[model samples]
Target: MKKRWLCLFVENEVGVLARITGLFSAKAYNLNSLTVGTTQDETASRVTISLFSDDQLFEQIKKQLNRMVEVFKVIDYTDIDIYRKEIMFLKILKCTENDRTFLFQFSEVYGIRILDFNKDSVLIESIKAEEENNLMLQLLYKRLDNPVEIVRGGSVAVEAV
Candidate 1:
């Protein structure tokens, strides 16, 4: 299976999101990430979805999406050289003094923006390529004492040169 990021443009109407998601759920397809919001055209919305499936299944998914009444267009970025990135907000809930020092150093190296901090936890926001998110989480897991909470803002992309 391969990872695919698809952008779906649909009518900005009630239950449209639900219907689209329902299609995936009903088919037992795995949706890894989803982000939906209105576009400049307030009448329409852009829904970005990331999923893991083989090439054949991916084609079927696209056809199904296009058949939906609400969908205006579908943009599949799986094979395109595009500028893709996902936003991640990580909250390091627990760590030692040594861990804190290491985190600060890591922040400096990675250019992480400190969103909040207190005696118990530290929050930082970052935007990076999809694969980079995994690498960043790995480093945090190795250093942090407790499980980290992560909020992923699904990937957005544009055409690259």
Candidate 2:
């Protein structure tokens, strides 16, 4: 099995997101990430979903998605090379002075920005854009003693890879 990104264009309706997600849940399909946003046309929206499946299963899912009433189009980016991005926010506790210094340097290397900082902890953000892999995120996770809290945005992609 391989990871695949499916970009679906659908009507921006009240229950569209639930209907789309329900399909995967009912079928017990494993979904890695899901992100939805309004498109240039206010009546339509773009949903970027990530999942792991083989070719056969992927084909079935695409067919089902195409059958939905609200679905305008479905693009499976498995074969095509597309640009991708994921944004992450990390909060590291202020346990020691050394940690702060180290994290500052780490941020500099990755070009991540410090969103906010206080006596208890620091909040940082990392935006991975036009990237090929998750090496930066992996390194961040391993380097931080362990973040007090972490929040990662869903992956979004566009343009040709």
Candidate 3:
């Protein structure tokens, strides 16, 4: 199965998000990543979803979404050029002075930012693709000796204009 991307334009109303997610759960279709936000019109919201599925299943998924009354449009982004990014925050606790210095340098090498730091802890932020974030998380887990905390937001994407 290959990864797929889809964007849905739907009415901005209560229970819409739940009903959409519920459909996925009831059908046993796995959602890799999902994000929803209101559009400039305010009456509608854009829902960006990613999943791993075969071509046939992906087509079925699109048809099902289109059948929903709340959905205004369903755009398949799987074969399109788009800009996508996920936000991640990684905090390292119990850091030493040396570790803090090392982290600052490390952030410069990677595209990560040193968001905040104290004598004992440092917070790093990264806004990048999901695969890149995953690799960074793995590297941090392997390299950092201090306790760590992570917060990740679902990916958002926009098609190339």
Please give the RMSD to the true structure for each candidate, in Å: 1.5, 2.1, 1.1
Query: Candidates' lDDT values, in order?
Result: 0.87, 0.84, 0.94
Identify the runs in model 3 with alpha carbons over 4 angstroms from their true place. Answer: none
Q: Write the per-residue lDDT of candidate 2 for residues 64-155, one digit (tens) a residue.
A: 99999999999988779888888888788754666777778878987888898776678888888524226765776686665567788889
**Each candidate's TM vs. the true structure?**
0.92, 0.91, 0.95
TM-score of 3: 0.95
lDDT of 1 by residue, 54-128 (tens): 999999999999999999999998888888789999888776667667777888898788787777677888899
Q: Report the Cα lDDT for candidate 2.
A: 0.84
**Top-scoring candidate (lDDT):** 3
**What does candidate 3's lDDT look like per residue over 45-66, in tens digits?**
9999999999999999999999
Give lDDT for model 1.
0.87
The stretch of ten residues in a row with the least summed lDDT in candidate 2 is: 129-138
* Clashes by residue pair, model 1: none
